[model samples]
Target: MGKLYVVGIGPGSIENMTIRAMGAIKNSQIIIGYTKYIDIIKSLIENKKVFSTGMRGELDRCRQALQLSRNNVVSIVSTGDSGIYGMAGLILELKKDEQVEVIPGITASSAAGSVVGAPLMHDNCNISLSDLMTPYELIKKRVELAASGDFVISFYNPKSHGRPYYLKECMGIVKKYRGGSTPVAVVKNALREGQEFQIFTMDSFEEDKVDMMSIVIVGNSNSYLKEGRFITPRGYKLMD
Candidate 1:
């Protein structure tokens, strides 16, 4: 049986992809991913059989990739770290007797933090606002805890068609424990060709301004604006 490589391409830019992912893609006979993401690196994989899917075809995509892997080396690419709500989950779920390897990438959460400044260096937690399969109550609980603990929060799937209200609800939860003046960055399409970075305070974030393509980062209670930048220190330690 052939092997599969679950690669994280990092946000929406080829530059963010790791050398290892590049190598894997080059060696793979089949490549699969969400259409828009695959389009970004289409030129790089001209020799491979490409499979693209839409938002709701995740299961179909995984199954097809697995079947392809049974005969040839296949690589399914995700936007961020495969462990953080990425395609690795679906691939593993579809796996029966096949082997797979996961290649990590710079997650949107981390890339967003870096683009906006250094707010992630301190306490931070990554959360997904999408409630397609998961319960909203759990997501709300996480926001509450992250807010109370003053942990910088990187939120994925902030909004979608019927789920636009999810982001608004999250804002309310965070505001309950944290101040409204807290820093928030709506890093959209981070590091991509058309990347748009919007800076706002927690109170200033209008839910309508955000969508599924964006990642919302809510700064911690201790997060401060310094040198015209948003910063969060991870708490210095003495090596001695």
Candidate 2:
């Protein structure tokens, strides 16, 4: 047993990754992650073994990483925070067969939020736009509940090649309860070298502007923008 750091590299950029994530990567003898994610850090794994793949092979990826960790220092990377729709859950599912450490990383939503200040200041829920593992109706219901409850929301797995309409669909669901002018924050390439942050009203965000690499934040009733950043107050008042 060598060390296995299930590190979260954060959304696709080297700059966005923390020193801790870098330290693990630098010390590792092996690196594993999705193919696109691996491409970002290709130079970092010069003399190390690298394993990369896309969807459907996620479980196999985890298994291979786990087995390798038994013999070497292995670092499995997730794009954003590993726990949020990352490799954490999948790794944990194999808990019965293996035990590994899950090193936290800044998730896309957190990075996205930071760009526009704090969109999750008060309370909120995180949801995904992808329907591969879930039903669209259920996702719709979740969006509806989040909208009705006024939860500041951070969305993950927003859109991909054939799923360009998911975000708009979610927006439509939210529009039913929230106004078109409601504030929405979109962060692309968060923390990465070429990061782009956009703050706009939900109804005005162009569908062409989002991609699988992007993260979308839907504001609550109290969420507002200050100096181009979206913020949601924690709602704490002083007793003075």
Candidate 3:
């Protein structure tokens, strides 16, 4: 039987992509992924059989990749770590008997964390505001709980044109527990061209600056900003 490798290419940059992921793609007979994601590594996949799918076609894409893998090695690509809101879970769930391997890559949270400093150096949680699979209320509850626990947060799939209200709703819940002065980092297109980010207090956060391509990082109560870098201390008393 042929092998199917689910590879995460990190934050759309050649530098951020893992060597293992690139190796899998180079070894595979075919490369498959969302068109946007495939575009990120277009220069690398040159001359390879590439299958590009559109938005909301994840199942179809994975099915195609899996079917093709029955005879030829296939690399199914996703942005960021494949298991984190990527194709690894669906590919595994749909695999009946096909040989599959998941290649880990840098997640958006980690990329965003690095860009904004060390907001996630300690305990943190990730939540996606997109309700396509999960309900908005459930996401809200999670945000509220995370806030109450004083956990640093990394938000993925935070906002899009269709559901702009979700970001506001989630942030409102967070504000109830974390004051308006809480440090937050808004990052878009991490490690990719057109990358942009800004540090803000929770009250000063601008939802208008966010989009589907953005990741938002919120620091816990103990987190603070120094020289424009947002940081959350990991109980290191020596630093004090």
- Taking the tens digit of each residue's C-alpha lDDT, what string does model 2 give over 209-239? 7777678898887777777768788987848
Report every candidate's CA lDDT.
0.84, 0.82, 0.92
CA lDDT for candidate 3:
0.92
Task: Estimate the TM-score of every prediction.
Answer: 0.92, 0.89, 0.97
Clashing pairs in 1: none
Instruction: Give the per-residue lDDT of model 1 (tens digit) for 111-153.
Output: 8888888888877888888788789998898888888887888
Model 1: CA > 4 A from native:
237-240
Evaluate residue 216 in candidate 1 and report its C-alpha lDDT on the 0 to 100 scale. 90
Candidate No. with top lDDT = 3
State model 1's lDDT. Answer: 0.84
Off by over 4 Å in 2: 237-240
Q: List the residue pairs that clash in candidate 3.
A: none
Residues 44-123 of candidate 3 have per-residue lDDT tens digits of 99889999999999999999999999999999999999999999999999999999999999999999989888899788
Comparison by lDDT, 2 against 3, better one:
3
Ranking by lDDT: 3, 1, 2
